[model samples]
Target: MAETGAPRRQSLGFLLLYALAWAGGAMAYVPFLTILLPARMTALVGVSDVEYLGYVTFCGAVAASLAGIAFGWLSDVTRNRRGWIAAGLVLTILLLLAVPLAKDVWTLIGIILLWQLALNMVLSPLAAWAGDCVPDEQKGLLGGLIALSPALGAWSGAIATTPGLVSVDGRLAVVAGLVLLAVTPVLLFGRPRPFPELTAPPPVCADGDVAARPRGPAVRMWLARLLVQIAEAALFAYLYFWFRSIDPAMQDNEKARLFSVALTLAVPVALLAGRWADRRDRPFLPLVIGASVSAMGLVGMALAGDAGMAKASYLIFGIATTVFLSLHSGQTLRILPRSDRRGRDLGVFNLTNTVPSLIMPWLTISLVPGFGFETLFLLLAALAAGAVLLLATLPRGR
Candidate 1:
C-alpha cells in the first residue's frame, strides 16, 4: 500500500456548513431527553419517574449502539457513506414528527428506539467521515469542528426547551425541519472529493515502513481516548439530574443557562486544545493532563453544596472536558489502522462512546440510591484518572 500524503486544508465555508448541519441533526436527542420526553411522559402518561426514564434511555442507547455498528458496517461495504447519512436524517425527521402522537410509555419508547437507530446511522458515519476527508495536519481544525458539536447541540436543545416559546411537539417539529433544511444543502453541494493523491503511499519495509499502520504509541493514544470518552459519557448521562438534585427549585431556563455556560467554556477551550495538538505535536501529555484536571473538576462537583460553587465546578468540568476531547480528536487520525477503513474503524471506536450509556443506567441505579450522586462523581473521577494513566503509557513518536 502506498502512503497517502497529508490532506489539504478544507475551506472554512465547508467546515461551517458541516458544523451547522451536524448541530441541527445532533440537537434532536439532547432536548428530547433533557426536556421533551420527560415533560411529555409526565403530562400524558403520569410517568414522570426518574428511574423509568433512566431505563428507557438505557434501551435507546443499546438500540443506538447496535444500529450504529450495523449501519456503519453496511456503509463501508456499500461505499455510500453519505447515502446512509441522508437516509438517517430523513428517518429521524419523520420519527420526530411521529413522537407527538404517542399516548403511552411503550409507544413513546418504541418511537424513541426507531429515532435513535436512525440518528446513530447518521452520527457514526459522520464521525468517521471527518477522518476520511480531512488530512492529519488539518485534524486540529477538524477536531475543533467535532468538539463544537456538543456545545452546538446543547444550544439548540436549550432553544427548543425555552418556556412557552414552543410547545414540546412544536419544538420537535421545528428541530426536525431545521435539521433537514440545514443538512440538505451540505449533502447536495459540499461533496468532498476523495483525495486519491493522499491515499497512495510509498512501499513499506518489513519492520517500520508500513504506510497506514499506526505505531505502538498511536494505538495507546486511541485506547486512552476510549477510556476518557466512557468517563465523559457516564457523567453526561446524569448531569441534568445531578443539577436538579443539588437545587430542587432550579428552573428549566436556569438549568439550560448553566449547561450553556459549561458548553461555552468548553467550546473555545476545545478549539485551543486542538490547535495546540496540531502545532505542538503533544498528544499524550495533553490528554493525560486534561483528564487529570477534569477529574479534579468532577471531584469539585461531587463535593459542592452551594449554587455558586456548583457553577464554578461546572466551569472547570467544561474546560477540562473541552481540552481532553479536542486533543483526543486531533490525535485519532494519527492512530487509525488504515485510511480506507476509517469509517469502519471509527464505527468500532464509537462503540466505546455508546457502551458507556448502556452501563450508566445500571451504574446509576446501583449507586445513586445508596451512595448518591456524589459517589457517582467520585467514580467518574476514578475513570478519568484511569484514562490519564492509560494515556501516559503511550510511546512518544511522530
Candidate 2:
C-alpha cells in the first residue's frame, strides 16, 4: 500500500474548521448516550433501568466494535473518508429521527444497536482522517481544539432537554438539525489535499525489523487510553443519573448546563496543556497529570456527603478527563507505525473506546445497586490511577 506521506501543517483556520466539524459530529450522538438514552431507558424499563442499561450498552458496544473495524477497513480500502463520513452521518440522522417510534424496551434496544453501528461508521473514519491528515507537530493543539467538542456536545444536550422540546421526536429533530449545521462547513471545505508523492514502508525481514519497533508505544498508548476511557465511560454514560441521584430536585436541563460548564472550563486548561506538551515535547506528562488529577476528583466525589460537594467533585473530574482525553487523542496520531493503514489501526485502537462501554454498565450494575455510586466512583478512581501508571512507561518523544 502506498502512503500519503507526511501531511503538511494546516493553517489555523483549516484546523478550526476541521475541529468544528468534528464537534458537530460529536454533538449528533453524544447527548443521546449521555442524557437521552438513559432517560428513555428509565421511561421504558422503569425499575429495570440498571439491567436494561447494561443490556443496551452491551449490545451497542458489540455493534460499535464490529462496525468500527469493518467501516474503518472499508475506508482504508476505498480511500474515501469524506464519502464514508457523509454516509454515516446521513444514516445516523435517519435512525435518530426514528428513535421515538420505539414502543418497547426490545424495540428501543434494536434501534440503539443500529444507531451505534451508524454512529461509528462516521466516527471511525472521521478519526482516521485526523491520523491521515494532521501532522505530529500540531497534534497537541488539535487535541486542545478537540476538547471543545464535549463542551459543545453537552450544550447541545442541554438544548435537547429544554422545556420547549416536549416530545422525544421533537428533541431528536432539533439535535439532528444542529448536527447538519455543524457538519456543513467540513463538507464544504474538507476536501483531501493531493499527496503529490506516495511513500513506501521500510523493508522488513522475516522476523520483522528489530531496529525500529512501533508496536510497543502504540499498544501502550492504547492501554493508557483504555484505563482512562473506562473511568470516563463510568462517569459519562451515567452522569445524568448520578447528578439526579445526588439532587432529585435538579432539572434535566440544569444537569446538562452544569455538565457543559465543567467541560467548557476545561477547554482553556486543555488547550494550555496541549500547547505546553507540544512546546516541551513532553506529551506523556500531560496524560499522566490528567489521569492523576481526575483520580483525585473521583476520590472527592466518592467521599462527598452533599449535592454541592458532589457537583464540585464532578467539575474537577470533568476538567481532568477532558484534558486527558483530548491530549490522548492528539498523541495517538504521533505514534502510528504506518500512515497507509491509519484507518484500520485507528479502528483497532478505538476498541479502547468501545470496550469500555461494554464493561461500564456491568460495572455500574454490579457495584451501584449492591453498594452505591461511591463504590463505583472509587473503583473508577483506582482505574484512573492505573492509567497514570501505565502512561508513565511510554518512551519520551513517542
Give each model's whole-structure lDDT.
0.73, 0.84
Off by over 4 Å in 2: 1-8, 191-213
As a whole number from 0 to 100, the lDDT of residue 348 in candidate 2 is 91
Residue pairs in clash, model 1 = 2-201, 3-200, 3-201, 3-202, 4-198
Residues 1-398 of candidate 2 have per-residue lDDT tens digits of 12447535656776787788788767986788888888888888898886888898899899999999889889888888888989888888899998889989999999988988888888888888777666666788989999988888888998899997667658888888888887767877875443332213335678885323368788888988898899888888888778888899998889888888998998999899988887787878889999999999999999999999999999999999998998898888878767666778888988998899989988888898889999999998999999888888787673
TM-score of each: 0.89, 0.93
- Using TM-score as the measure, the top candidate is 2
Model 1 agreement with the true structure over 1-398: per-residue lDDT tens digits: 12456435666676777776666665767566666676676666553566767777788888987887788777767777789889998999999999899987889889989998999888767766666666666676666676666676667667776888887579888667767776777778776655564434435678976566745655566566666666676656666677777787887667766776777677777777677766776655667778988889989988998877887987787778766775576577667766666666666666666777787778888999899978988887888888888887675535
In model 2, the clashing pairs are none
Residue 226, model 2: Cα distance from true site in angstroms: 0.8
